[model samples]
Target: MTDIPLEHVHVAPEDGSDGEPAPAVFVLHGRGADEEDLLPVAAELPDDRHVVSLRAPDPLQGGYTWYELDLSAGGLESSQPDAADFRRSLDLIVESVEAAVDAYELDADRIGLLGFSQGAITSLSLLLEDPDRYAWVVALHGYLPESHADLDPDGIEGKPVFVGAGAGDRVIPDSRTSAAVERLEAVEAAVTHGSFPGGHGIGPQELEAVVEFVESQAR
Candidate 1:
């Protein structure tokens, strides 16, 4: 199990000047990153919504992680984290989103998720398992987690999703990316897939695409 407990999360409040209940976007970081890690991306995103970033629950090396991993055991796709621990992380993310909505008076119809790597795992899991709660998703350099195998594909039809992957990423092979897209589409998610000419990380080009995707979703 993870040693670090998730008690505090970081949030960037929105300035809703239009006297409307602005939408809120929950930002989740990759493993080994903190709540503030994705704040810059949040800055680049549309400023119309509240940007709340969540930290994972487990401690690792000098950073934190969503769950334990066995990297050398044939890469991430085959490797699995503790199921119970994964479930808890999933629940905590949902709780954080709900709490933010209540505290900020956010529009219930405009909540979204943005995640990278392990954060992608958590965000994707929550959105897939409970499609009704999230309006859209943006997952960066990630694949489906093992615990999410039982999601009903028909549960999230017509939902918008943005998937950004690295074409040269040695960590998560293209096979995994293809599978992820297939799975999301099987559930009938309108996936706007983009590939960058990089390896295992998000680039400026990809971020531009993501920003465009986020804007389109808001409309």
Candidate 2:
């Protein structure tokens, strides 16, 4: 759909809806990965909802990145994001979701977000910026952006969230994911935090947990 803001791959529900508004989960890929990068994960999602996997706006090392990394404060693994690019990408994602709501006949109240690495960072930021806009979130191998520290947590109360991390992840540490979980918990969000043994990528255990979390939320 041209009206939708970002370049994406839209997967229809496995089961036919017969014109009813279907629930939707918007998928965002990690840095240097395109919209197609996370499509395999979509196969595990509940069969009754729409899956929209979005490509980042900026081109990067043959793929795309939501924002440039700021490495002045630390090494590549602990680097921060360029504030301008990060905010722009966030706004664009918001617009994309709003447009998709009407374009895809999605159930606005059941909107969910699934993201990895940098994508996970953005997803969590979106939830914090306007917690009521999303029904649930799944963020894997990512941390909360520093710019979102002043969020109003009231709207996030009881919202279901799945935070996953790799114990051996060098790019985004488990500590970072834990910090995000703590922040969400402080807001009274219903959060499920998990850590798998691996390095910088999703494993079988992580994927299974993700599917289970989404299935529970979908129900």
Candidate 3:
């Protein structure tokens, strides 16, 4: 097993890389979910890309969470992340990406991030922190964290970002996703927003759009 920074499951490229470093898409699941939760979705992505699904570091409830949520403000809509835990998790993800690149023989220039909910939030934060590090990002049912208020990194100009939101999602609310889209657009990232007709999860159409997005990048 190629040891990276986090617990993960690596899915090899269906089409061999032909001795060249292959592109990779790293998967990050939502809170209360594990690495295996998104394997099915990962399977639908481009076959030429290596898929690495990572388990969150901190165990929570029966699953795992990228970081703890501060619900003291009331419902999930008002909840914010514990800043310290968020930063720590971000650092760990960065380390894991570096290790994954070397161990998996991945093309570092084509790294993509696909995340859900809290995982989506982390992906957006990572892109903002170091836009040049990632080629594209897909965040489903997630919002930009408040901790990034002072962060406005350069080099993110024209970065591709996909923000997906559910119209009836009470857990995250569509407004939050809209705000994230605005923020990404303000930063000059090429933002493609998709709205589903369901609640806090990815629907069939949403998944299709995600696949299409990843396919475009893979080619």
Candidate 4:
């Protein structure tokens, strides 16, 4: 796969202002999902925040993936990501975010990221790697990989972060959630984590909380 994600789309604001650059949100889908998967969530975000949904770089069975998964260690909790592709995808996402800012006249200082499952892993990976690059981050049904070690957690201070997970999620266990929280705390991030009643997918309550987070950060 190329170092760039293959597909993307911009969800423009209906009441956008002329000349004033709008704040933006980048939405990423989980494994086995497409760019169109998060469009409904995009449609629910605060109207002032422009949306960008991206497809993963590496194509899987019928869908796409940010990186290859290695579950040989057993269970989803012990899974590993292909280091090379993960880094490549991160580079591509950063490039895309930069390009989106320039092309859409977006406010770079106010950009937030939202991701689900594998998408969430990629999003949090980027945020932790360079905490200064994002205004906020929302990680859903995902956890931070122990392999990402170049981060200065202290730089994430005051940065808004929301971690939404399903209490009954067999895909992501509580151990992973706790580990993610510990990692984020080490960096001093302003975090809001919520666990709802569900499994591996996003629910209405999750959406509402995540939307509130992005909207609050955009303000």
lDDT of each: 0.78, 0.92, 0.91, 0.84
Task: Estimate, for each residue in 1-219, the C-alpha lDDT of model 2 and write its tens digit.
Answer: 999989999999989788988899999999999999999898889999999999999999999999999888888767778999998999999999999999989999989999999999999999999999999999999998778855766688999999999999988989988988898888888999999999999899999999999988754
- Where in model 4 is the C-alpha error above 4 Å? 1-6
Which stretches in model 3 have alpha-carbon errors above 4 Å? none
lDDT of model 1 at position 38: 83
lDDT value for candidate 1? 0.78
Expressed as tens digits, the lDDT of each residue in 2-89 for candidate 3 is 4687999999898898999999989999999999999899898878889999999999889999989898888889888888899899
lDDT of 1 by residue, 131-186 (tens): 88889999888888666755874459888888889989877765676778888888
**Using alpha carbons, what is the TM-score of model 2?**
0.97
CA shift of 136, model 1, Å: 0.4
Ranking of all predicted structures according to TM-score, beginning with the best and ending with the worst: 2, 3, 4, 1
User: In angstroms, how far off is 79's CA in candidate 3?
Assistant: 1.1
Stretch of 10 with least lDDT, candidate 4:
1-10
Which of candidates 1 and 4 is the stronger one according to TM-score?
A: 4
Candidates arranged by lDDT, highest first: 2, 3, 4, 1
Selected candidate, larger lDDT, 1 vs 2: 2
